[model samples]
Target: MAPQPKHKNIVQILTPVVLFSFFSSSLAEIFFEERFEDGWQSRWVSSDWKRNEGKAGSFKHTAVKWPGDPDDKGDDCFRHFAISAKIPEFSNKNRTLVLQYSIRLEQDIECGGDYIKLLSGFVNQKKFGGDTPYSLMLGPDICGSQTKKLHVILSYQGQNYPIKKDLQCETDKLTHFYTFILRPDATYSVLIDGRERDSGSMYTDWEILPSCKIKAVDAKKPADWDDREYIEDPNEVKPEGYDSIQREILDPKAKELDNWDEEEDGIWRPPKVPNPAYKGPWKRKKIKNPNYKGKWKIPWIDNPEFEDDPDLYVLKPIKYVGIEIWQVKGGSIYDNILLCDDPAYAKQVVDEVFANREPEKEAFEEAEKVRKAKEEEDAQRAREEGEKRRRERDYDRRHRDRDCYRDRYKRHRRGYSDDDYHVS
Candidate 1:
């Protein structure tokens, strides 16, 4: 029997189906299998197993339950296992060396101990077996140490931060999810049950790939003492540098002046009135009073020769002082707009304030004058130097012109002598 050609739509559908099936099978081979009784399978391998530096034995044989329970009855146990493969998904220029494993904890125990540990963060195959890497335990057991705590650790540039804490660990009968996203910057973060922890900034800095800023936990801490820890992503922090800001100038308008009040003890107090009559423009006028038109003596003016003494006639110094103090305390808007209502009053206060500090103002003014004089001197020196250069250039050009004329005259004399010899 002859075979029939497949339909175009059927080929298209089958192509994707076959591709998806192949992809799923390949991923299944790479990822650890989830078996209930067996715990989690390992998807990685260590090269230093032969040297006895790592957990020695077969991949599955070395996978033992925590607290050395062979029955696997503990809350934490390995579920699956595999030899490590070069994970292209998690590998790049910013290489993050990580060992991931699946762990199952039965219930919230007094102390949680099931943690996917990373012994070393380097791919130096020989270093793992050497004395250097063996001497240091690369990671810490965060969840196993604290009750009801699920901890995820992220290490970047030799520094470590716990990505997750189970102070508020949620308990459910179903599977509890804990996954980490490792970036090329050697920084990582964890998500539990699809929700991120409050300390998510660690992941942000790692993902953002920012330069690390190492700050002392406490600014005033001693070199030997441990600083009180604070929540901050070192990578996201501003680097130490300098910045400039524009300065603000005070406003030109403000307010002053009000009627004198004696009832209030702390209020304005008018100066004592002089014994002599207060004189004004009206007092000097020749207009006669209604009662005594013919007589020059006015009732309001007891003494015609009265010359007002400001010390006795003016308002008390305390009254003016009170107004200035009020304006200063009234804030920018009140001080600039309300208190400066009368230009005359504002100018008077300013003059009085500056009059008392005339020496300091004069000294500043003298310094500014000196600075101006120095600048003028520098400009004059520059002009003189430029003029000198110009004069030297002009003199050289004149000398060159004279030399050219002398050379031409010598050449003409030689030519005339040669012509005469030829003629002879």
Candidate 2:
């Protein structure tokens, strides 16, 4: 080993004291006074008072109970303050800064919006007229949980360091103290109530510098992104069965291409051959028949008409099952029933199906309207009942006062009558 490292007596004697002082300052514990004396000296206290406008006034101080009248209408969340002086100024190289304090929120309000934010790295925005102040934040944005808990968060440069602590408090009394420590270096760690609860680290490139200079950032103009130039809507009405089963036959995304008909020549068309037999696009896969096991002599099903056009064949009644259909050469027969089924019955069924659906839709709308109407009616009735009760109470109070006044007048007249008559 090299010569034993020299340790001066002075350094050895003072090391523990220096370390203790450093830790004591970093801890920054708050002690509550026993009596109801000046609460301001007990750092980060609130003096929020309820004003006549049902809002908390700007004046903040310290008090024993909640600072204002309880009927302020706004939330009675914590209006206290927090101060941490242990955090040091950030330089380019220095990485770690930690601050810890005890926070106890009054249980009078809902805990949904309770939060504790440790702020440091101060900057004056009034000098630059900028929106954000230069600081780092590490705290809990606790909402929806009332159980006392602790949180650890780190803010390095501009991005948030994702480290958190959720610890159940040992007690619920307002005087509970929790010690928190934050370190933003190779990692961030938090100690809650003298125990380490969480830690996290951040990537290196996120070191954004705090600057006092302000410059004009670009504001986007509204016209850049809009594409609605000029297009007229035809508002076409589709047939009843259009949305029902027709979607099964058509590829949903396939629509007529907008510019397909436009070209240098008149109505551009694809090349076609005339007088060709129906050699369909189906291959060997279409040759196999469905499993029947000779149960019924359904020989007409083997013909290619059923295979070529299922929409036409599947609906044909058993009477026309074997009828062989001929190819109609280019004469458009649009207004004809292609299938041999009872077309009138099919039409009736389709109409009746849509008609039945209409009542369901109408009933849903009616129910919604009725619910809304009932709610309004209930509110109106409540108001009327309240007014009636107030009027009845006022009448009863006036009647009581009138009877008391009459009795007092009779007593006075009886006392004065005999003496007054003799004197007259």
Candidate 3:
């Protein structure tokens, strides 16, 4: 069968969702999103990454599960290197900031980033690079053990800080929906495949949260405070012969060999073993400490820098949405990026996109497995056929040699000249 085109009919698969987005809820405004359905190349600014890394670079569009080798420059799929698009401006002030996207890590990621960043500063469309500043970076950042986590970094006051809780990301070679929602009440939630995995108040979860309360300026630990809860007994003492007993003794089972000679052969000695009755580092028994107080702590006072703005949940103006990444082996297909202010609507987007994807994924995996199995079977059959042909050739050669030897022997034994066997 002739191979099918790499990119085909992806927009048809997402037509329903794309049509629905036009009729999406009026309250929730979708500032930016990309399904990469058709002609998505016009939307994004593709970097000329071929000059630098002559080996692997570029992102392509394809409907199939496997897009084929990325190094093939002639393949229809090697479209762009990195993902970075110019999006419209939108503000999350007093509204929920929902950032969601679909990503498939289709490559064997040894040590690289499989994450996306949402940049907000004044970005040069053609000059976006790895060092370009971004406001929020979310998704799995995989390297060695030094960094392996679902990195959630939110920039506040020109400083970037990570979320306090450890959010583990999906590392499997499959498509996953990552949704990050920062609500108007300073609370944030992250969902994978439409299931909530991590959620908390951004004020408490991120170090960017300004301290509303602070320690008192003159606070100090009282000098008379006693924090110890246990003390040694006053009358405890060691026994008279405690020090004389050895901590280890010779094992009775380890008998000296009978052939031992002290002068010439050197005598064998029994191996020393731990003494069963030995106790290590004897100390006085602990007693309840009287007049003991709890651990000392300083009182907190109001922080002058903190002004309760009832709108801590409100984020700054979001101008553009982009995927700033530094992937090592780059075959990460990113699509269906929906930015809105409604949780239910965002979830609706997820449901619409991945509604039947679960079943499709299963079928896709099964097909791949079958393809591999068939390939192995074909390879084995070819090997067996080659071996059979080799054996037949060997048999023919042996029979030919036997016939030539018989003819030569018969000619020599009959006393005829060797030339008589030839017709000429």
Candidate 4:
């Protein structure tokens, strides 16, 4: 046979890979994406639910304060904000769902929630608030030191269940990306700044369903059961005079002062210090109990109430994505929200769009240094001015006092009455 061309062989080998890539890209679908560019207000609905109470915050479309793409504007929340955008209804019944977004806590958020909610079904976009029903909520909730965690809450059967895992969130005054992926197999993954922070089965991580096995309530410890592993040694007894040892004793080196009088100073006593010879209350030595039983555990039985859910990972038809937050001191900028069915796409967005975080952080640190330097300089100038004023006041007061004294002396030399030379 004639020799086969090398290029033909290479093309034959690469055909399957290229086809697979094409199919994979076609399968990935994006349900919603918000970049907060111009004309974004037409797509988003700002709720007036708290506006009458003056609690509704306004969102300004602006770019990051530090170094970043000037055209990359985000929704800047200055207070309590409730805004949402309607997305095409989609069901993630048998596919992976990815929710990703970027947040910039420019004000170093003291206490507030920076989470976004995915609402299912019909929602009055004009009245969307905290009470609005949502299928999923994902983002960081910061409240001082105690609450600085990224929350991942999934709603199932009218009840919302929060993730049991404690995931620490980024608290720096810079932009960060938060990504969450929920697979059809009931497994979920949480990522922060493009790094996987946590991943596990949704069945185990969330309390959406009853446990498959539970401790038997009917099982009880028998009357003869002995769970203690150790007992006091029978041969050990309290030593003689042990109870008489005092916890505190007079210092031997302390001496009464020579000037101290017995009647005036009361009875002179040396300060009491911790006694060296004294041991604390006696404790009998422990010995391994011969008849000791191991820890008693109630037998686990199949939970009758437990029911396996084949669709435990399925959320309702998500139709709207919202940003409803309550911030005390707000300067959080939310941007680049994406809802898709492919984690790979979400990761690519992070690597491309949100990759300027390192530069943003560098710019923030440099700005902070400049601000601190300016504050210190202003403080030093204020101090110098204050000292100058104090010196001027002191000089005037001293001169005035000397003049008064000289006038009194002159009056006295001239034989004026003592009352005539009254000091002012």
lDDT of each: 0.30, 0.31, 0.68, 0.79
Runs in model 3 with CA error above 4 Å?
A: 1-24, 49-56, 66-80, 144-147, 214-316, 371-424
lDDT of 2 by residue, 1-424 (tens): 3332122100000000011122323333222111112332242222222222222212222221221112111111122211211223233223233333333232322332222333334422112111222233322333344554443333443444333334454332122223333232444445443355554433222222222222323334344343333333334344444334321233334555566746544664444333233343322222222332332221222222222211210110111100000111100000001111122222332233233334434544565588789999999999999999999999999999999999999998888756677853
Instruction: Name the top lDDT candidate.
Output: 4
TM-score for predicted model 2 compared with the true structure: 0.28
lDDT of 3 by residue, 74-119 (tens): 1122312344676776678878888888766655554555456677
Q: Which residue runs of candidate 4 sit more than 4 Å off their true CA positions?
A: 1-25, 217-297, 396-424
Of 2 and 4, the candidate ahead on TM-score is 4
Task: For candidate 3, give the lDDT.
Answer: 0.68
How many clashing residue pairs appear in each of the predictions shown?
23, 2, 3, 1
TM for every model, in the order presented, reads 0.25, 0.28, 0.60, 0.71
Q: How close is candidate 3 to the true structure, as a TM-score?
A: 0.60
Residue-level lDDT of model 4, residues 1-424, one tens digit each, is 5442222100000000011122444667989876665577889898987877755656554445664543455444345678889988999999999999887777766688877899998999989998999999998889887999889999999999999989888888776899999999999999987889999998789998888889998999989888889999989989999999999999999999999999988999999999999989999999998988899999899989999999999999999999877776646667778899988877777777545656667788888999899999999999999999999999999999999999999987899678886988
Clashing residue pairs found in predicted model 4:
57-80
Q: Single out the weakest 10-residue window by summed lDDT for candidate 1.
A: 8-17
Better of 2 and 3 by lDDT: 3
Query: Ten-residue segment with the worst summed lDDT in candidate 3?
Result: 8-17
Q: Which one wins by lDDT: 1 or 4?
A: 4
lDDT over C-alpha atoms for residue 14 of model 3:
23
Per-residue lDDT tens digits for candidate 1, residues 20-80, read 1222233222212111133222323343433332222222222211211122221111111
